[model samples]
Target: MNHSPDTGTFQVIHAYTRAEAIGDGVLVDVTDTAREAGYLLPVAMTSAAWAEAVAWDETNRALQDEAGRLWDVLWMARPAAARTGFGQTRIAFDVLRVPNHPAATEPHRVTLHVHIGPGDDGHAVLTVLLAHED
Candidate 1:
Protein backbone atom coordinates (compact mmCIF):
# COMPACT_ATOMS: atom_id res chain seq x y z
CA MET A 1 0.00 0.00 0.00
CA ASN A 2 1.14 3.52 -0.80
CA HIS A 3 0.92 6.09 1.93
CA SER A 4 1.26 9.81 1.46
CA PRO A 5 3.69 11.64 3.73
CA ASP A 6 1.63 14.85 3.85
CA THR A 7 -1.46 13.01 4.98
CA GLY A 8 -1.48 12.64 8.74
CA THR A 9 -2.88 9.17 8.44
CA PHE A 10 -1.16 6.10 9.70
CA GLN A 11 -2.08 3.00 11.61
CA VAL A 12 -0.62 2.35 15.02
CA ILE A 13 1.34 -0.85 15.02
CA HIS A 14 4.31 -2.11 16.98
CA ALA A 15 6.03 0.94 18.38
CA TYR A 16 9.39 0.20 19.91
CA THR A 17 10.66 3.11 21.93
CA ARG A 18 14.02 4.22 23.31
CA ALA A 19 12.93 3.54 26.87
CA GLU A 20 11.81 0.08 25.90
CA ALA A 21 15.12 -0.60 24.17
CA ILE A 22 17.08 0.37 27.25
CA GLY A 23 14.79 -1.70 29.43
CA ASP A 24 15.15 -4.64 27.08
CA GLY A 25 18.96 -4.40 26.78
CA VAL A 26 18.74 -3.47 23.12
CA LEU A 27 20.18 -0.06 24.00
CA VAL A 28 22.34 0.99 26.90
CA ASP A 29 21.65 4.40 28.36
CA VAL A 30 24.88 6.33 28.72
CA THR A 31 23.45 9.75 29.35
CA ASP A 32 24.76 9.78 32.90
CA THR A 33 28.28 9.06 31.78
CA ALA A 34 27.88 11.43 28.89
CA ARG A 35 26.86 14.21 31.24
CA GLU A 36 29.85 13.43 33.37
CA ALA A 37 31.90 13.85 30.20
CA GLY A 38 30.25 17.23 29.57
CA TYR A 39 27.46 16.29 27.23
CA LEU A 40 24.33 18.41 27.41
CA LEU A 41 21.96 15.97 25.78
CA PRO A 42 20.84 12.47 26.61
CA VAL A 43 22.86 9.72 24.96
CA ALA A 44 22.57 6.02 24.32
CA MET A 45 24.61 3.28 22.67
CA THR A 46 23.31 0.38 20.70
CA SER A 47 23.77 -3.13 22.02
CA ALA A 48 26.37 -3.78 19.36
CA ALA A 49 28.34 -0.66 20.29
CA TRP A 50 28.07 -1.58 23.96
CA ALA A 51 29.35 -5.06 23.31
CA GLU A 52 32.27 -3.89 21.24
CA ALA A 53 33.32 -0.79 23.11
CA VAL A 54 31.86 -0.80 26.62
CA ALA A 55 31.55 -4.39 27.74
CA TRP A 56 34.37 -5.45 30.07
CA ASP A 57 35.04 -8.53 32.10
CA GLU A 58 37.65 -9.75 34.55
CA THR A 59 39.36 -11.46 31.65
CA ASN A 60 40.28 -8.10 30.12
CA ARG A 61 40.61 -6.22 33.38
CA ALA A 62 44.35 -6.44 33.26
CA LEU A 63 44.38 -4.71 29.90
CA GLN A 64 41.43 -2.37 30.06
CA ASP A 65 38.56 -1.10 32.16
CA GLU A 66 34.97 -0.40 31.24
CA ALA A 67 35.14 3.19 32.38
CA GLY A 68 38.21 3.92 30.32
CA ARG A 69 36.78 2.23 27.26
CA LEU A 70 33.53 4.07 27.59
CA TRP A 71 35.40 7.30 28.00
CA ASP A 72 37.38 6.66 24.85
CA VAL A 73 34.21 6.16 22.86
CA LEU A 74 32.71 9.36 24.20
CA TRP A 75 35.93 11.27 23.79
CA MET A 76 36.14 10.46 20.13
CA ALA A 77 32.48 11.23 19.64
CA ARG A 78 32.86 14.66 21.12
CA PRO A 79 34.95 16.19 18.35
CA ALA A 80 33.18 14.24 15.64
CA ALA A 81 29.83 15.53 16.80
CA ALA A 82 31.12 19.08 16.81
CA ARG A 83 33.10 18.95 13.57
CA THR A 84 30.29 17.62 11.43
CA GLY A 85 27.38 19.84 12.38
CA PHE A 86 26.16 22.12 15.07
CA GLY A 87 22.60 20.79 15.03
CA GLN A 88 22.53 18.06 12.40
CA THR A 89 20.26 15.07 12.71
CA ARG A 90 22.79 12.43 11.72
CA ILE A 91 26.56 12.24 11.94
CA ALA A 92 29.02 9.52 11.18
CA PHE A 93 32.07 9.10 13.39
CA ASP A 94 34.90 6.70 13.85
CA VAL A 95 36.60 5.48 16.99
CA LEU A 96 39.48 3.18 17.68
CA ARG A 97 38.19 0.34 19.81
CA VAL A 98 39.81 -2.69 21.28
CA PRO A 99 37.35 -5.37 20.41
CA ASN A 100 36.14 -7.89 22.94
CA HIS A 101 37.77 -10.60 20.91
CA PRO A 102 40.25 -12.77 22.68
CA ALA A 103 42.37 -12.98 19.58
CA ALA A 104 42.45 -9.23 19.17
CA THR A 105 45.81 -7.77 20.03
CA GLU A 106 45.44 -4.17 18.97
CA PRO A 107 42.88 -1.45 18.65
CA HIS A 108 40.81 -1.53 15.48
CA ARG A 109 38.95 1.30 13.84
CA VAL A 110 35.20 1.17 14.31
CA THR A 111 32.74 3.47 12.61
CA LEU A 112 29.87 4.65 14.76
CA HIS A 113 26.92 6.64 13.57
CA VAL A 114 25.14 9.12 15.77
CA HIS A 115 21.55 10.14 15.26
CA ILE A 116 19.99 13.11 17.01
CA GLY A 117 16.26 12.72 17.16
CA PRO A 118 13.21 13.21 19.32
CA GLY A 119 13.08 11.24 22.49
CA ASP A 120 10.15 9.27 23.75
CA ASP A 121 8.69 12.45 25.18
CA GLY A 122 9.81 14.85 22.42
CA HIS A 123 13.10 15.87 23.97
CA ALA A 124 16.29 15.86 21.94
CA VAL A 125 18.35 12.71 22.32
CA LEU A 126 21.31 10.98 20.76
CA THR A 127 21.63 7.35 19.79
CA VAL A 128 25.01 5.88 18.82
CA LEU A 129 24.80 2.82 16.67
CA LEU A 130 27.13 0.59 14.70
CA ALA A 131 27.85 1.71 11.16
CA HIS A 132 25.54 -0.92 9.72
CA GLU A 133 22.76 -0.35 12.20
CA ASP A 134 19.80 1.96 11.77
Candidate 2:
Protein backbone atom coordinates (compact mmCIF):
# COMPACT_ATOMS: atom_id res chain seq x y z
CA MET A 1 0.00 0.00 0.00
CA ASN A 2 1.10 3.53 -0.70
CA HIS A 3 -0.15 7.07 -0.47
CA SER A 4 -0.05 9.80 -3.02
CA PRO A 5 -0.71 13.49 -2.95
CA ASP A 6 -2.71 13.55 -6.16
CA THR A 7 -4.59 10.32 -5.66
CA GLY A 8 -6.09 8.72 -2.60
CA THR A 9 -4.26 5.86 -0.91
CA PHE A 10 -4.49 2.54 -2.68
CA GLN A 11 -3.31 -0.99 -2.08
CA VAL A 12 -1.24 -2.96 -4.49
CA ILE A 13 -3.34 -5.89 -5.59
CA HIS A 14 -0.29 -7.98 -6.28
CA ALA A 15 3.32 -7.57 -7.12
CA TYR A 16 6.10 -9.58 -8.73
CA THR A 17 9.47 -8.73 -7.33
CA ARG A 18 12.93 -9.07 -8.74
CA ALA A 19 13.81 -11.71 -6.20
CA GLU A 20 10.70 -13.65 -7.05
CA ALA A 21 11.46 -13.42 -10.71
CA ILE A 22 14.93 -14.79 -10.09
CA GLY A 23 13.54 -17.56 -7.97
CA ASP A 24 11.06 -18.41 -10.67
CA GLY A 25 13.74 -18.37 -13.34
CA VAL A 26 12.08 -15.55 -15.23
CA LEU A 27 15.27 -13.67 -14.53
CA VAL A 28 18.77 -14.98 -14.02
CA ASP A 29 20.86 -13.26 -11.38
CA VAL A 30 24.23 -12.29 -12.66
CA THR A 31 25.20 -9.84 -9.95
CA ASP A 32 28.27 -11.76 -8.80
CA THR A 33 29.70 -12.19 -12.24
CA ALA A 34 28.66 -8.67 -13.16
CA ARG A 35 30.72 -7.43 -10.24
CA GLU A 36 33.65 -9.23 -11.72
CA ALA A 37 32.92 -7.20 -14.84
CA GLY A 38 32.87 -3.96 -12.77
CA TYR A 39 29.13 -3.61 -12.15
CA LEU A 40 28.37 -2.45 -8.63
CA LEU A 41 24.60 -2.73 -8.83
CA PRO A 42 22.34 -5.74 -9.00
CA VAL A 43 22.14 -7.31 -12.44
CA ALA A 44 19.87 -9.87 -14.03
CA MET A 45 19.04 -11.11 -17.49
CA THR A 46 15.62 -12.07 -18.77
CA SER A 47 15.19 -15.80 -19.38
CA ALA A 48 14.74 -15.15 -23.05
CA ALA A 49 17.89 -13.11 -23.09
CA TRP A 50 19.73 -15.91 -21.36
CA ALA A 51 18.45 -18.54 -23.76
CA GLU A 52 19.03 -16.48 -26.84
CA ALA A 53 22.23 -14.67 -26.01
CA VAL A 54 24.19 -16.26 -23.21
CA ALA A 55 23.30 -19.91 -22.90
CA TRP A 56 26.10 -22.14 -24.17
CA ASP A 57 26.26 -25.89 -24.49
CA GLU A 58 28.47 -28.73 -25.68
CA THR A 59 27.34 -28.09 -29.21
CA ASN A 60 29.52 -25.00 -29.13
CA ARG A 61 31.63 -26.06 -26.19
CA ALA A 62 34.67 -26.72 -28.33
CA LEU A 63 34.81 -23.03 -29.20
CA GLN A 64 33.18 -21.27 -26.22
CA ASP A 65 31.87 -21.42 -22.67
CA GLU A 66 29.11 -19.78 -20.68
CA ALA A 67 31.52 -17.67 -18.64
CA GLY A 68 33.20 -16.28 -21.72
CA ARG A 69 29.88 -15.47 -23.39
CA LEU A 70 28.52 -13.83 -20.24
CA TRP A 71 31.73 -11.83 -20.00
CA ASP A 72 31.34 -10.66 -23.55
CA VAL A 73 27.83 -9.40 -22.85
CA LEU A 74 28.98 -7.37 -19.85
CA TRP A 75 32.08 -6.13 -21.56
CA MET A 76 29.97 -4.75 -24.36
CA ALA A 77 27.45 -3.25 -21.97
CA ARG A 78 30.14 -1.19 -20.22
CA PRO A 79 30.96 1.16 -23.05
CA ALA A 80 27.33 1.51 -24.04
CA ALA A 81 26.44 2.53 -20.50
CA ALA A 82 29.36 4.93 -20.29
CA ARG A 83 28.55 6.69 -23.52
CA THR A 84 24.93 7.21 -22.60
CA GLY A 85 23.68 10.05 -20.43
CA PHE A 86 24.04 9.15 -16.78
CA GLY A 87 20.39 10.02 -16.17
CA GLN A 88 19.19 7.73 -18.91
CA THR A 89 17.00 4.90 -17.76
CA ARG A 90 17.57 2.55 -20.67
CA ILE A 91 20.72 1.60 -22.53
CA ALA A 92 21.13 -0.43 -25.67
CA PHE A 93 24.16 -2.49 -26.57
CA ASP A 94 25.09 -5.08 -29.12
CA VAL A 95 27.11 -8.26 -28.81
CA LEU A 96 28.56 -10.40 -31.56
CA ARG A 97 27.50 -13.77 -30.29
CA VAL A 98 28.49 -17.10 -31.74
CA PRO A 99 25.34 -19.08 -32.33
CA ASN A 100 24.89 -22.16 -30.26
CA HIS A 101 23.19 -23.56 -33.35
CA PRO A 102 25.41 -26.47 -34.25
CA ALA A 103 25.40 -25.69 -37.95
CA ALA A 104 26.14 -21.97 -37.64
CA THR A 105 29.52 -20.93 -38.92
CA GLU A 106 29.98 -17.36 -37.68
CA PRO A 107 29.17 -14.88 -34.97
CA HIS A 108 25.99 -12.86 -35.28
CA ARG A 109 25.22 -9.55 -33.67
CA VAL A 110 22.33 -9.18 -31.27
CA THR A 111 21.09 -6.12 -29.44
CA LEU A 112 20.47 -6.31 -25.73
CA HIS A 113 18.63 -3.65 -23.84
CA VAL A 114 19.45 -2.69 -20.28
CA HIS A 115 16.74 -1.23 -18.12
CA ILE A 116 17.42 0.48 -14.81
CA GLY A 117 14.39 0.74 -12.62
CA PRO A 118 13.13 0.39 -9.08
CA GLY A 119 13.17 -3.11 -7.72
CA ASP A 120 10.63 -4.49 -5.24
CA ASP A 121 12.20 -2.45 -2.46
CA GLY A 122 12.69 0.61 -4.62
CA HIS A 123 16.43 0.23 -5.06
CA ALA A 124 17.47 0.59 -8.66
CA VAL A 125 18.23 -2.70 -10.42
CA LEU A 126 19.45 -3.50 -13.87
CA THR A 127 17.88 -5.99 -16.25
CA VAL A 128 19.36 -7.15 -19.52
CA LEU A 129 16.74 -8.28 -21.99
CA LEU A 130 16.27 -8.74 -25.67
CA ALA A 131 15.47 -5.57 -27.60
CA HIS A 132 11.85 -6.64 -28.02
CA GLU A 133 11.30 -7.33 -24.32
CA ASP A 134 10.07 -4.97 -21.67
Candidate 3:
Protein backbone atom coordinates (compact mmCIF):
# COMPACT_ATOMS: atom_id res chain seq x y z
CA MET A 1 0.00 0.00 0.00
CA ASN A 2 1.16 3.55 -0.87
CA HIS A 3 -0.50 6.92 -0.21
CA SER A 4 -0.18 10.64 -0.97
CA PRO A 5 -2.22 13.75 -0.44
CA ASP A 6 -4.46 14.92 -3.25
CA THR A 7 -5.29 18.55 -2.57
CA GLY A 8 -6.49 18.54 1.09
CA THR A 9 -7.61 14.96 0.91
CA PHE A 10 -5.39 12.00 1.79
CA GLN A 11 -5.29 9.44 -0.99
CA VAL A 12 -4.22 5.84 -0.91
CA ILE A 13 -3.30 3.69 -3.89
CA HIS A 14 -3.41 -0.07 -3.46
CA ALA A 15 -3.05 -3.24 -5.45
CA TYR A 16 -5.25 -6.10 -4.24
CA THR A 17 -3.84 -9.49 -3.49
CA ARG A 18 -4.51 -12.78 -1.72
CA ALA A 19 -2.03 -14.61 0.49
CA GLU A 20 -2.94 -18.14 1.43
CA ALA A 21 -6.51 -17.38 0.20
CA ILE A 22 -7.00 -14.36 2.46
CA GLY A 23 -7.24 -10.79 1.18
CA ASP A 24 -4.50 -8.27 1.86
CA GLY A 25 -5.69 -4.91 3.25
CA VAL A 26 -4.92 -1.50 4.82
CA LEU A 27 -5.74 0.35 8.03
CA VAL A 28 -6.20 4.14 7.78
CA ASP A 29 -5.92 6.29 10.90
CA VAL A 30 -7.84 9.46 10.17
CA THR A 31 -7.61 12.62 12.25
CA ASP A 32 -9.68 15.70 12.82
CA THR A 33 -8.46 19.23 13.63
CA ALA A 34 -8.62 18.40 17.33
CA ARG A 35 -7.57 14.75 17.57
CA GLU A 36 -7.71 11.23 16.16
CA ALA A 37 -10.95 9.96 14.63
CA GLY A 38 -9.95 6.28 14.85
CA TYR A 39 -9.21 3.84 11.99
CA LEU A 40 -10.58 1.96 9.02
CA LEU A 41 -9.21 -1.04 7.15
CA PRO A 42 -10.85 -0.81 3.76
CA VAL A 43 -11.01 -3.92 1.63
CA ALA A 44 -9.88 -3.74 -2.00
CA MET A 45 -8.58 -5.86 -4.84
CA THR A 46 -7.73 -5.81 -8.59
CA SER A 47 -8.86 -9.09 -10.12
CA ALA A 48 -12.21 -10.71 -10.80
CA ALA A 49 -10.88 -14.00 -9.46
CA TRP A 50 -10.31 -12.45 -6.05
CA ALA A 51 -13.73 -10.87 -6.13
CA GLU A 52 -15.33 -14.19 -6.87
CA ALA A 53 -13.81 -15.66 -3.75
CA VAL A 54 -15.13 -12.82 -1.61
CA ALA A 55 -18.51 -12.19 -3.21
CA TRP A 56 -20.23 -15.40 -2.30
CA ASP A 57 -23.76 -14.39 -3.34
CA GLU A 58 -23.17 -13.35 -6.94
CA THR A 59 -23.96 -15.59 -9.84
CA ASN A 60 -22.09 -13.32 -12.22
CA ARG A 61 -19.08 -13.25 -9.97
CA ALA A 62 -17.15 -10.72 -12.03
CA LEU A 63 -19.81 -8.01 -11.97
CA GLN A 64 -20.89 -8.99 -8.47
CA ASP A 65 -17.39 -8.65 -7.18
CA GLU A 66 -17.27 -5.01 -8.25
CA ALA A 67 -20.59 -4.26 -6.59
CA GLY A 68 -19.59 -6.19 -3.50
CA ARG A 69 -16.42 -4.22 -3.06
CA LEU A 70 -18.36 -1.01 -3.57
CA TRP A 71 -20.70 -2.22 -0.87
CA ASP A 72 -17.79 -2.64 1.49
CA VAL A 73 -16.96 1.01 1.00
CA LEU A 74 -20.59 1.85 1.57
CA TRP A 75 -20.67 -0.04 4.84
CA MET A 76 -18.20 2.32 6.43
CA ALA A 77 -19.55 5.38 4.64
CA ARG A 78 -22.36 7.80 5.33
CA PRO A 79 -25.51 6.93 3.43
CA ALA A 80 -26.69 10.49 2.82
CA ALA A 81 -23.41 11.37 1.14
CA ALA A 82 -22.86 8.32 -1.04
CA ARG A 83 -23.11 8.14 -4.81
CA THR A 84 -22.93 5.36 -7.37
CA GLY A 85 -22.89 5.65 -11.13
CA PHE A 86 -21.88 4.13 -14.41
CA GLY A 87 -18.63 2.28 -13.83
CA GLN A 88 -17.97 4.10 -10.57
CA THR A 89 -19.03 4.31 -6.90
CA ARG A 90 -18.40 6.87 -4.15
CA ILE A 91 -19.07 6.83 -0.41
CA ALA A 92 -18.13 8.91 2.63
CA PHE A 93 -17.50 8.04 6.29
CA ASP A 94 -17.72 10.74 8.94
CA VAL A 95 -15.35 10.96 11.90
CA LEU A 96 -16.72 12.51 15.05
CA ARG A 97 -14.94 14.72 17.58
CA VAL A 98 -15.10 18.06 19.41
CA PRO A 99 -12.38 20.53 18.47
CA ASN A 100 -10.36 21.86 21.37
CA HIS A 101 -8.09 24.13 19.34
CA PRO A 102 -7.97 27.72 20.50
CA ALA A 103 -8.93 28.99 17.05
CA ALA A 104 -11.63 26.40 16.53
CA THR A 105 -15.37 27.02 17.04
CA GLU A 106 -16.99 23.87 15.71
CA PRO A 107 -16.53 20.20 16.35
CA HIS A 108 -14.36 18.59 13.74
CA ARG A 109 -16.17 16.14 11.56
CA VAL A 110 -13.85 14.33 9.21
CA THR A 111 -15.45 12.85 6.16
CA LEU A 112 -13.81 10.09 4.15
CA HIS A 113 -15.06 9.40 0.65
CA VAL A 114 -14.07 6.32 -1.26
CA HIS A 115 -14.28 6.27 -5.04
CA ILE A 116 -14.18 3.04 -6.98
CA GLY A 117 -14.40 2.06 -10.62
CA PRO A 118 -13.12 -0.21 -13.35
CA GLY A 119 -9.86 0.52 -15.10
CA ASP A 120 -9.40 0.43 -18.87
CA ASP A 121 -8.33 -3.19 -18.67
CA GLY A 122 -11.31 -4.09 -16.44
CA HIS A 123 -9.29 -4.14 -13.24
CA ALA A 124 -10.65 -2.22 -10.23
CA VAL A 125 -9.56 1.32 -9.42
CA LEU A 126 -10.02 2.85 -5.97
CA THR A 127 -9.49 6.39 -4.70
CA VAL A 128 -9.96 7.70 -1.15
CA LEU A 129 -10.94 11.25 -0.16
CA LEU A 130 -10.52 12.76 3.30
CA ALA A 131 -12.00 16.14 4.18
CA HIS A 132 -13.06 18.06 7.29
CA GLU A 133 -16.43 19.72 7.69
CA ASP A 134 -16.29 23.37 8.50
- The candidate maximizing lDDT is 2
User: Weakest 10 consecutive residues, lDDT, candidate 1?
Assistant: 79-88
Give the total clashing residue pairs for model 1: 0
Q: RMSDs, each prediction? A: 2.9, 2.8, 17.6
Quick one: ranking by lDDT, best first? Answer: 2, 1, 3
- TM-scores for all candidates: the values are 0.84, 0.87, 0.27
Per-residue lDDT tens digits for candidate 2, residues 1-134, read 56676777677778888899999999999999999999877889999999888898776544887898999998888776565447787889999988887776588999998888888888877889999998
Candidate 3 lDDT tens digits, 88-111: 476556543233223433434545
Per-residue alpha-carbon lDDT of candidate 1 for residues 1-134, written as tens digits (9 for 90 to 100): 34558996776667899999999999999999999999888999999988877787757524887888889889888766565446567787887877776666588888888788888999888888888888
Whole-model lDDT, model 2: 0.85
The candidates, ranked best first by TM-score, are 2, 1, 3
**Candidate 3 stretches greater than 4 Å from native:** 1-75, 78-82, 86-88, 97-107, 119-121, 132-134
In candidate 3, list every pair of residues with a backbone clash: none
> Where does model 1 exceed 4 Å of error?
1-8, 83-87
| Candidate 1 positional error at 7, Å | 8.4
